[model samples]
Target: MSSDRTASHLARNLAALRHARTLTQQELARAAAVPRSTIANLESGEGNPSLAVLVKVAGALSVPIDELLAAPRALVRHWPADAIAPRHKGRGVQVRDLVPEPVPDEMMELMDFEPGAVMGGTPHLPGTREFFTCLDGRVILMVAGDRYELAPGEVLAFPGNLPHSYQNADALQRARGVSVVVLAKAGV
Candidate 1:
């Protein structure tokens, strides 16, 4: 999927889901705790949505976060970096989705970590697990109060129900890595 198509899918899916529940734009916005304008922009495919916004909307709709972002798909989807890979920026980090369509129970993302970048994540539902593999540089992952240092080619796996955080360990170099999250129960 290209970026344009991704936006179109989001617009279509959002509107369809909202209508399916007989929700007006304002109603859905209230449910999602977002401004009506945000919902309008998202449904019009005219604005960038942060991960937090997507999460809130999905929760309000009683759907998975991926349900809002994934494109309709057949088997054997291919995500070319230049096309469907929209880099989602955080305070000091960058992330790209690696899957064009949502899998039954999984999420994959590529992360670029600038020096001093830190990301904190709340606990996922029970039975969820997350894995991280360092592709370049180093990072310190803190999960459930346990800190683990990961270098290139190293990997770490842990239950996602634990509060977690990560930071680039190298003060002068950026780090890159892949993160895979598995939900024990699909679409939960």
Candidate 2:
């Protein structure tokens, strides 16, 4: 299945489970340790959650992670874990692998982004270079006092050591995109 479909499916599952229990966005946010807007976005089908999020939400709702994140028609391309949920680094942003896990040691996986999302404000990790491309909408990228607004089909590449963040320029709709981290060759 496509990333969009998978994201939509996960969002739906989260919404259903979150609402069925009479939990407000704020309540769920507290229980899950996510932002209230994140919950709103998930329920509205405009956000995707990382594996950590899936786990926290499941724990708060008192259910198994599989119950809220299983994809009926989507099977893992490799290990079963790949089909479970993608893990993320950073906060206030949803991220998951776009490909199967145990990504060849030579390569890394993609981090998915949603509308109005920003990766946690932290220093980027070393030993890698990162790139991004907008899949469906515009994205505003800011780093080291520089800012760039990228439209669909545009791509940006940069060293991953600078502090960085992103935002969806759209006032509405999901600003879908992917972050590619190509790890530097060892002993470079």
Candidate 3:
């Protein structure tokens, strides 16, 4: 491909990757040990960066150099239900992986709580956050000595490092919820 094409790809990929990680240009520059203007210029497709700069940026993003130069591809991905196996946490609790593939610093799970079922949440690293949303029925969430009752479509956000647990509020109905945990970046 031509240099302009390669630069365009790099600009798009770099911006997308940075946004996906929720990093500012200044933050990425600090991580890559480059000037913030360098990142800004690169993302704008106005910089013809040196090989050393590219290598540093790639290393900071934890991606290969080829990815920065490759043509953009569709981001949509489909995961069939049967493709993922559910984990039985206990007699009445089931947890299914929402994201089958490993994602850095993030995890998502679909949880089902049978009548009167309870499941304790595992604490994560400091600065991690957990978001739980009730999709069906009702769920009782206990965190840090506080109790929250969540109905369908209700959401609760809390520190992932806190002691927390979930329980089905109904005695004869099953409760379903989705939990998304975002972990802190290492060394940050």
TM-score, ranked from best to worst: 3, 1, 2
lDDT (CA) per prediction: 0.84, 0.69, 0.92
Cα shift from native, residue 120, model 3 (Å): 1.0
Per residue, candidate 2 scores C-alpha lDDT tens digits across 1-95 of: 78677767777777776666667789889877888887787777677678887788777777788766557554324557546576665443556
Q: Which ranges in model 2 have alpha carbons more than 4 Å from their true place?
A: 1-82, 87-92, 104-114, 121-127, 185-187
| Candidate closest to the true structure, highest lDDT | 3
Error of 2 at 99 (Å): 1.8
Estimated TM-score per prediction? 0.56, 0.48, 0.77
Cα error, residue 4 of model 1, in Å, equals 37
Angstrom error of the Cα, residue 56, model 2: value is: 37
Task: Name the lDDT value of residue 91 in candidate 2.
Answer: 41
Error of 3 at 9 (Å): 1.0
lDDT of 3 by residue, 40-126 (tens): 999999999999999999988878898888898986778788879899886698999988866557899999999999998998888
Give a tens-digit lDDT track for model 1, residues 1-188.
77788788888889988887788999889878999999999999996899899998998887787777788764255656688665645557788887665544578888899988898865778999999999999989999899999999999999988999888998899999898998776344
Better of 2 and 3 by lDDT: 3
